[model samples]
Target: MIRKKLNLFLVSLWSVWMLQSCGNPPLVDSTDLVIYGGTSAAITAAVQAKKMGKSVIIVSPDKHLGGLTSGGLGWSDTGKKEVIGGLSREFYQRVYDKYQQENAWKWEAKSDFGNKGQGTPALDGEFKTMWIFEPHVAEEVYEEWIAELGIEVLRDEWLDRETGVTVENGKITAIRTLSGKEFKGKMFMDATYEGDLMAAAGVSYHVGREANSVYSEEWNGVQTGVYHHRHHFQVLDQPIDPYWIPGDPSSGLLPRISAEHPGIKGEGDDKVQAYCFRMCMSNHPDNRIPFPRPANYDSTQYELLVRIFDAGWDEWFDKFDLIPNRKTDTNNHGPFSSDNIGMNYDYPEASYERRKEIIQEHRDYQSGLLYFVQNDPRIPEKTQIAFKEWGLAKDEFVDNDHWPHQIYVREARRMIGTYVMTENELLQKWPTPQSVGMGSYTIDSHNIQRYVDENGHVQNEGDIGVPLPGPYEIAYGSLIPKKEECSNLVVPVAVSASHIAFGSIRMEPVFMILGQSATTAAMMALDQGIAVQDLSYTSLRERLLADGQVLTMEDRIIAK
Candidate 1:
């Protein structure tokens, strides 16, 4: 009996130990550089660090890497192709190489694709680059880079902001994820759209538009009457009613229409610009997947859309821009489309679970939108037939039922670093110093609020699209935090910029360029045993120029 009791105790102790071991997360290997977020910038940073002979790992919150680039934004929002160089240009060149193969055009012939793009030729032989491509192709390029460089990426690991981050003497020594794994590194980079790691490290950031006066800017705040693009209320010929019942004051406002008052123009607010999923769809019969009506679909939610049709504005197929292989990078065009405005005001700071709910809501909204445009009897027959020809691409996003995994987070938490980029710098009115990269895109902001105007008509506010004079240099200081906050951290995607300035700087190619620059700076800082902010600009500029980064428009020879 004594022997049996002893054996039972031993078994119990072993079981308890096994359980404890399973519950504890494995210790992540310490490295020279740790990058958070699985964005394209993250991939670029990892590759750059690896090339610089620094041990690096990408701690990604997403299972899939390449945030928007792989998430159905195939139609690149390129401004000036000449300004894109370095690894950013290399990525596009790889896409060109992929397309050069005949098998890449599975749904359509390569010759039928024709040459089409924004600022440059779709196929540039001199540069050997293609600006437009499919989502899967972009993802494949990122994966190829990872495979070639042997860069390690930890997928599906989220940072535990509450207690997971361990800061020592104003520097992040280690960061723990919600999965219990801890990554220790000498230098860190936050390349997420939400700026989660930057916030977790106690770095200061702003969530919404700052007042124009705050930055001595022109296009920063609640722009109500000042309209620059066709995305505003100007698109409507006749005033559309906001209530469920037309011209009835007793009825409540329609879904997705806010009843709150729009603030004064040029004033600051905590409201962020709208976000939507840049859907990848195809017209090819074999590659098309019929739009499945979401289980949570409610036709009543689209009451405003029906009212818009009655108003006689039928430009539905305007933004269904064709990419390659009969697929299109469909985006929001007019007043009522894919943009789920006024509903995502809380998403920037929401919890993970709340963010999931918001994402699901957006997915449902867009899915139902596709279905409604194709099947609804109220829609014009001509428009319905046009929309019916397009469906979700079967070969794209197969892992998640053909829908894009990421939503276009147009604007999110922006860091307030050592230097805040403002409109004066973007417009070239003020000389930008410590140049790192260049941004040439226009200052484009989606609608922030859709509310009832003073004249009792529904109007959208905060859609500002102003063209820039030329490409302006992005300062390296904007990527680093105040020395007292964090000495060894760099933020590329969520750089320090005012809302107007970020609108111009927040393009995907720009993010990739900045990511490479940030990695170079991090490697230099590590070698010199100094903080990122204290790194010498002369050495950094020389290295960047040697690496083929276009720091000024004068360096670019635009083919007339």
Candidate 2:
């Protein structure tokens, strides 16, 4: 009996030691910080915590890091490079440093890349600028950030959002993932574009577009007269069938287009910005994957596309935006782009199975569209040949059958926090407090939904692209959920923006910038032993300046 007791005691002690070395199991009752949603912001937060001498781990459903940064937006959309300081700026600088070597471009010398830098500060052969890139290169930068931080990342571990979130005494005590593991943390950060974790935490949020009257803003919801890209009337000259019941008796609905009438020109509605996958494709013969016909291919859904081709819309072949490594950060274009506008209405609040189905539908739509454009007999010969010249990127997304892992959810679940950034704020009307960073991209929203125009023809709405007068401030308050709702959580990417305001903040570089600022907030809260909302803004602002974040473009510059 004595020997048996000794063995049991030894086993228990060994287990305890192992737990400390690796990490306490889920709900193991410990963790300095737990970040929800594995995004560019989450990674930045983990880095900041680790730097401040705290143990941190990321719980995410995605297997990859750097949400959209590494997703497919390689070419960053940096409106003003000088204003992009802090972690957001660091991401691009790192890309520049990586390519400074002769070995960076491989067979091509600096001469072959060209001189006109795409939207960003990148130099073809010229000097670096801000904006745009290939997906793989961005992924490499994110992977490097992970390596340098030594973060404990648990990928594909979903938040049991419904019952998995456990809060005690006004604090989130633990979170359970789909893998049946629980995570305990003193503080949490919601870095996802969808604001999923914040919603689960009972943080107040808003979905869909708001009325121009409510926020007293110009651009919101089904905007009519604005046409930036050729996505509207340039080609959709006639009426398309309304998806209602056939022949009479209220056929009542179309397949993808919504039945409800889209609201007035400047008024707001429940419609959300469209979503799609940011495809990563390559032209390199060795790495290129051939585009194949989708299993659920449907020809009728693309009748408009067929008509576009017939109308000499032969620009389809040249639509792809190429990135480094011969890969493309493929995006939506023309009248029928990748966005399945009305198709994803239920995604933000849908079950995992339902979400998966939506994702598959988008995949089929995009893939089948590509296949149809290249293979369908209805397409003009030049357009087909041009498309055939390109193929599915063979070398990219090697893990998931070369398909991009993420779907571009432009906007969803915006937190109705203490401070809601309205369109007036983006236009520099409100005096934001303790500003942490600045953004310059115009207020841009994609097609909110398909609707009939005043001219009685079918069309898409909410594609507003208005430029900002100048660089403006993004407040620290925007990052925190209301103090009354949840004290220890911070939301960076899905900061308190009115739906229209988010159009500008939705860029990758801007997201990275916010990620760094949020981490700074998290660290300050930890060091002071207070809720994230209660952290002293004076100190927070100072620290942000020291860390190189551009708070304001005040004639005299300030740094954190």
Candidate 3:
């Protein structure tokens, strides 16, 4: 009997060990707030929660911090800098402070790096803020900020989208990650660009652009003929035929050109905007890593690009926006640049495995494009020669082979919260209530699809860039889900907004601003023992103003 009992006990112990080995860890202590994502918004929200004396934990799916900010998008898209206040402005101030040191300029001198930006100077000494910086510098700032605040971050902890969230009476009580680590919190903030937590919590959200009629907005849906930016094929000297053999329909379409009919101008479609990695390239020989040819690279994939070049489009380096130390935040520029048009339509709702596949495909495409630009014989000799001077920055995203760790999601699952911000609200045709933050960037959307036009010429569609008259207030209701859905959760990055409105609001600085505001509201709600949705906006506004958040155009004028 004793021997049998011993055998059973040993078997039970082995089972327990196996479970632990498979990543089923114990439940963590509940905190006041559980902030998910490793983006700039997550960092800002964590910092704000800490400042408010609330116990917070950042459960990050990413190994690195500061999503796109630390990811290659060093050149910021701040439309009006005066409106970027609170932790958002402070982040830029920290970057400026970092650059002040002589050692900060390693590859180049600060004097040699001009202060040019979108409109204002990149390094604003008077404002004590730097709008542009290197990827490593941004990551360093986030890491130091987190360390300074002693914020606990559980890295590589992905939330289990299925059977993970424990909701009771329409409030998320705790969330379990795939590793079986359970995190309980009184309040939760989904700061991810993808809105993973918000979706998993059963919150109502939108994936693609709504029709113009849905929101009564002029720039919300499939914009087939509208060409706002220089990203359309119309910029080419002449029309490029979509067929593999110039004008022969039987020869089949060239790679990357869709065979489907381009949708109606104002109609809605279930398609999202293109996504790309904002490549950080370096001209400096010492800090440059030559672009590696992706294993699955097919030179044929860029046949359309060759045609674009053939059509006399040569502005390849137009968006190699320079940053510190001779590096650049190279973004998608012309018709056939880095933005992988129409490839990421399903990424917003894709599973982790599928998302990885999509991300890898994008990596391969972008990497191959770089390799093709420098080495392909079809590329213009002069263009190839010029492109060869630049390579991936060796110092950034070291773990990810000098490539950016985060893909610019641009737009994903925007939650359908208490108030849905539309173009009407952004253009001041409709009033935005309970302002928590502000954004002034132009309403921008990258190409959603590339198809053959009526003339049988290849063309890109859905790249809209409508300029804003001025900075507009962001509604506080845009951050919270409908009270009946999930009361404890607040979304900062994927706040509720129409597709066009999101274009203006998706900037990193605005995300940080919203993040701080969301956290402040969360803390206030916790103090009052109320659901986040029930938090009084009047009190929230007072706290936000006190915390230096610019929520209105009036506030911007006063600050200026």
Candidate 4:
């Protein structure tokens, strides 16, 4: 009886503490637009909405803004800079403005920073654009823009998926956060990597790769044999043993190797491309933090890596992509790197606490792998020494202990909107509809699963890196749900697209462009009092072109 009373008292105290932490629920307020993400898209959307004479608030699930841009993805994956215009190009130009100052270069000399980038110069003096930047600098730019726009951003306000979204006659009237703060809005934009808002708002979405036959496209599904990138195992050189005891099936498969078949080629499955945190490493000793030995560090987890190294795979520093100063945006490379393949299949629809657990596991796996490569004697001495020279940049992600807060969620819940952007549309075989933005990046996807091959050797599957013929326009319909299911929401980041097509449209710059377009449509909808789908393409096109959005190529524009 005494113990029961003590438990009740403790529970009562905890409930009171939780209520205090969340703060008193704000009086229900209304805005013209409520963007439901703190990503680069969300920031740009809020700015656009504010500029278009609409009162807007950013209800962000993240504490920090700019998502991957402010994360360690400083090595921008820009396909063609000519296609990037309006707010997207403005973002890069702002990055240039920041780096143009003399004090921006702290760790290294400006001249030492040679003009190197993906298909363009790192710093374009004529265009006033800086593609490569530090994570902190990108975050600073986002904050500066929000402050300048006087846009209110409610950080750490997680959306309540259950009983929080109030819908009236197929429209979302208001959305309440997990903390009980309600935000009512006339229009909404779901700019999250995971389409949490869209999913909860009764919008249909897909979570995995669609079969090639589903969209009648060539590269849309389970690609077991297509190894476009160098992420697969060096199986051509030698068949690495999948089992602990070579050629023994009863001995069980090695760690990180899946036991299930990789599924039929060109068939759909729930597997998603691997996710990894882009590590910002620095060679400068003063600004480098040595890879800490993660708690529960198990060297045995990396036995597969040992086998990979033995097979002459020495491309460890292949993706230590240089950004700014002395920092490098280190990402997954080789067969066994930062990508936690086949681990995040459930992350798209996972509960918040469950997602946290998954994030911690990824953190442990990455940190342990780093520690193993640098400190383990089993690793080649030369490789170990080379890895030891690089460490996490001390100046970046300071709040998260120099670790990137955002994980690279390559693909998640892609909303199945009015017009699904498929590989056919991206490859230009089928004509794309009503252009809102352009995506020029390659149809790139990281490895999905590390499975044992038919030869009984471990092989990585589903690593596609097919470059597109040219830049393609993304449709406005891809951002809006079917007219019956939520009429007010616009999903930019997780736009309606097949897995392969999303691989191209999922770049950060494209998200910013789509965000601007979505908000523009939202403002128009507010003024005219109509559904987003009901907006005419002619008017939307004129407005977008007026705002300096590159809707089409120069020849296409002339032809039209």
Candidate 5:
């Protein structure tokens, strides 16, 4: 304990020294726009602002450019491609232009990039498939945008958040980091998944699942009876008894099942969505990097998975979604997949070191999972052999031990903005106003937690997979806070969505689309010298339409 405290003191001292060494960008009183986050949306928004002749700076915690789009979420969820326009479309067109080059494909022949070039129906369109790509490729596209616009970027600088600085009046007077460097701007956009800037700015947001009663949302909170997919291995005869003693667990606790029973159908709980690393896996014999057992490996933790393997649950392909370059953006599916739920409760609000520990725990759990799938004797020989051939991709995310630096944070603190998009809005009860983009994916939420059922069996809950009737417009109002909340601020990724409604619209493509729209709004607000909320809807709507944004499905622009 003494040594630990001394080490902590030393580390704090070192941090201070490093901050002083890094120095600060000249303290400016204001800029035309200041965007926070290194998300794809942040980049797109900055590019849009630059295009509109607005001086913009991106304050990011990331060393790289795009977030998930380049961070192993290559199997993109582009819901309504036709509605994606403006700078978002420009990004894909750039992807197409890259493939047009003869040297882009090293192993695969250029001409052979043919028929499959159309890509997934939901993901790709006539322009190109920017959705499915290698990490470096996506980063390059973003870097090009930065180069073209010459936008200033501050990398690896985290927001001090709790005590760094404050915004006064309609204008932000000072914004400081833990490092004590300050940034001030006229307009700020929190284009982050975590909503760090929003939280710091005192914006109201919720961090967990809301009750079904809250917004009359059909698919919210615990959902045990609804077996949306064949994720559970319970169907296998002699189902893995969710008990510690094989039958009697006055003995103790089981591997994955909690002692608590699955919660009520419509009850609200402090359950944030699950998180997992999007393993960039490959089967290429020469390029394959075998999944290594993590430093703190624990085989006992994987006993449930071993049971599933014993049962004839052979479809390893269930959670293995594909990506470019012979790799997969493997995801969690069913009750027991990669989502280490019930484990990340403190992530959104935790301190930096605690968050690191959580990240390591997830990494250890998932890596151990891969190792078990490949080498464990309990696994079917057929499954084992197939798994052995696949391993983490070699050429991706080299800095973070070949693992994607970010997790697929399915849901986090959602801001309750002026226009809270409820299920009613997306379900088409009321038409969305000022469509910046459109979304049509099913309101999908992965399992939130696993617990023992009343029947004394383990079950997963909070996994909803309901399809939307059709594409619906995402309102411009959703992206901006109420004028009184923060006049110059715009939120894209953490836009106003009720817990369940955000499930469909929170795709990377939608984030990118909204980022472009948010930036457009930022630049427009600057041009007209008005708050984002005070902008004339007629003029803003017209500009968005002219830029090819799908404001509404119906071809009515001026709402005449």
Candidate 6:
């Protein structure tokens, strides 16, 4: 009896220990660097740090690895492929290598898919790089790369924004997550879309558009009348009424149409650019999942889309960009497409719970729009038939109920670092100093708000797409915070830039490039026992060049 009682007690103790161990895992030790994001930039930064033999950890808020890159944005927005060098270029080359295998093309044959992209071949034979890919493929690359490097990634670990960061004497010592797990590090990088780490560290940043006067930028602030893209009411055959009752002033405004007067054209506002899921959709019947009606499906939410269809607009599939395996990287197209305008203005600074609500609202809005188009009797029969052909890619984002795991956060809290990149730098009006990387994509910002115009017609504002003259160098100072604000931190994803400038700089390849550059600076600073802001640009430039990073257009030309 005594022996049995002792055995039982031992078993119970072991069980309790196991439970405790599972509940509270062993804490991660202090590392050389701690990256707070699951973005492509974060992955690249980790890879660079590991390459340079630094202990690093990626505390990701996301369950998945890549932010938008693996989150359905398969059709890459690579501006100048030549300028994309280093690990960023290596990533595309790996994609190319992946396609060489017969197993990579599961849904479609490699030979059948045409080689075309935005002014470049989707499959570039000369460069041995593949620009377009599938979501799962990108995720696979990131995962395999991380695993190969043996880099540590802690997923679903959100930083405690309010009181997480422990900063002393202008440098962060550690950051605690919501789960109460503390991460200590000598250096830190905020590669998040929201710049959560940067914000928590008391770094200076901007939320929305800056006035043209503030930065002497031509394309900054509230652009009310400017409609560069087809995402405006100007595309409609006739002016649509904003009111629920056609022309009645007393009648309340229609759903999704804002009644607020859009501010002056050049004036600044707190509104940020819209966000949506870059859905990876498939038309292949065998691999497609029918669009599921959202839990909060409201038919009235898409009344404007009905009006748009009635106005002879039928280009619903305009942005269903093709990728490998008969999939599409579908983006916001028409006036009432996937871009949830004005709904995500508060996402940058919202609490974790509030952000979840916003993300769900956007998911519902986009999902309802999809279901509404295919099932609604009000939609054109032919259009409904066309829309019914495409559905969510069943194999992609399988963990998230066939929906994308990430929302395309187009713009968010941009760090105001040592040097703020403005439109002047982008347009070559003023020279950008300390070239760490380069961005050649056109300056692009999606619609901010849908409001009643001066003519009393419903229209979209803040959608600007100004073409850049050519490839321009990104300043290294943009990555480091002001020395007084924080000494050990670097922000690559949300680098210091004006709203108009961020429009051009905010691209995946650019993010990856900046990530590598930022990590190099951080690692180099660690070696010299200096702050990232104090690191010599000449030394940084030499290392970057040696690593195959194209810092200038002239370098690109020379490489060619």
Cα lDDT tens digits, model 2, 487-537, are 888888888988888889777767777878888887778778898888888
Which prediction has more favorable TM-score, 2 or 5? 5
Q: Each prediction's Cα lDDT score? A: 0.89, 0.75, 0.92, 0.90, 0.76, 0.92
Comparing candidate 4 with candidate 6, which one achieves the higher lDDT?
6
Q: Give the TM-score of candidate 6.
A: 0.95
Tens digit of per-residue lDDT, candidate 3, span 147-191 = 999999999999999988899999999999998888999999999
Backbone clashes (count) for model 6: 0
Which residue runs does candidate 6 get wrong by more than 4 Å?
Answer: 1-29, 557-560
Q: Please give, for residues 334-422, the per-residue lDDT of candidate 4 as tens digits.
A: 88999999889999999999889888899999999999999888888889888888898999999999999999889999999999998
The residue-level lDDT of candidate 5 at 535 comes to: 79
Q: Is candidate 4 or candidate 5 better by TM-score?
A: 4
RMSD of each: 4.6, 3.8, 4.2, 7.6, 8.4, 4.7
Worst 10 residues of 2 by lDDT: 121-130
TM-score of every model?
0.95, 0.90, 0.95, 0.94, 0.91, 0.95
Tens digits of per-residue lDDT for model 5, 116-147: 32234423445564555666677888898799
lDDT of predicted model 2? 0.75
Any idea what lDDT model 5 has? Answer: 0.76
Error of 6 at 62 (Å): 0.9
Pairs that clash in candidate 3: none
Error of 5 at 205 (Å): 0.6
Candidate 5 weakest ten by summed lDDT: 114-123
TM-score of 4: 0.94
Candidate 1 has an lDDT of 0.89
